[model samples]
Target: MSEVAVRMRLLQQSFDAFDESAAARLGLNRTDLRCLDLILAKDPMAAGELTTAAKLSPAATTTAIDRLERAGFVTRSRDAANRRRVLVAATEAARAAEREVYGPLGEAGTSALRRYGEEQLAVIIDFLETARRVQEEQTARLKKLPVRE
Candidate 1:
């Protein structure tokens, strides 16, 4: 692998470690925290949508939601436009956690980005988008493979 590939792997590992630590600090498992992140990213999102986004089985998603709700991180309600549908939302506690945990990280990221010019920033954005798309495609490909013993 090239140097960039090695660096990317390290970056992914760092992110995973950070996520685990953050989740632990909030008294949640990684899966539960991930579900909360999905809900926070899209407030009032359908439970089904969250399940898909989190790539969890329906039962697992339900359990995550239950845990988050019990922990005061999330709430479930009927969708206003579709009463039959259930929507998930982050609670104030969850928002506060996000602000407390990630606010400084966001500020540091923004400060780092400030060193780049507009064209450099555009390139960075394109690279990030392409990388994300490839990761999504790879995830789908993995999901299609037969389960191993």
Candidate 2:
């Protein structure tokens, strides 16, 4: 592979390790943290949409929501407009964890970006956007594959 490819692989590995460490420090298992992230990103999302975004089964999603609610990280309620639908929202606890856990990383990244010229930052942005799109495609592909026996 090329130097850029190697650097990208290293970045991904580092990010995975960072995420795992942050999740542990924040007292969340991976799935719960992931669910919380999605809910925080799209507050008051339909219950089914949160489940789909988390790639969790209906039963699993219910349990996760229950767990989050009990932990005060999330709240679930009937949609006012549609009584038949359930909605999930992130609570202040979730926002607090986000700020406490991810704030430094965001700040450091922003600081680093500030050191770059506009042209260099443009290149970085382009690379990051493309990499994210490819990673998403890979995630979709891997989800379709059966687990190893």
Q: Given candidate 2, what's the lDDT at residue 39? A: 91
- Per-residue accuracy of model 2 over 1-149 as CA lDDT, tens digit each: 59989998898899889989977987777888888889988997888998788989989999989888988898889999999899999898889999999899999989988989999989988988998999999988998999999
* Top-TM-score candidate index: 1
lDDT, each prediction: 0.93, 0.89
Q: How many residue pairs clash in each candidate?
A: 0, 0
- Candidate 1 lDDT, tens digit per residue, 54-140? 989989999999999999999899988899899999999999999988998899999989999999999999989998999989988
Off by over 4 Å in 2: 143-148
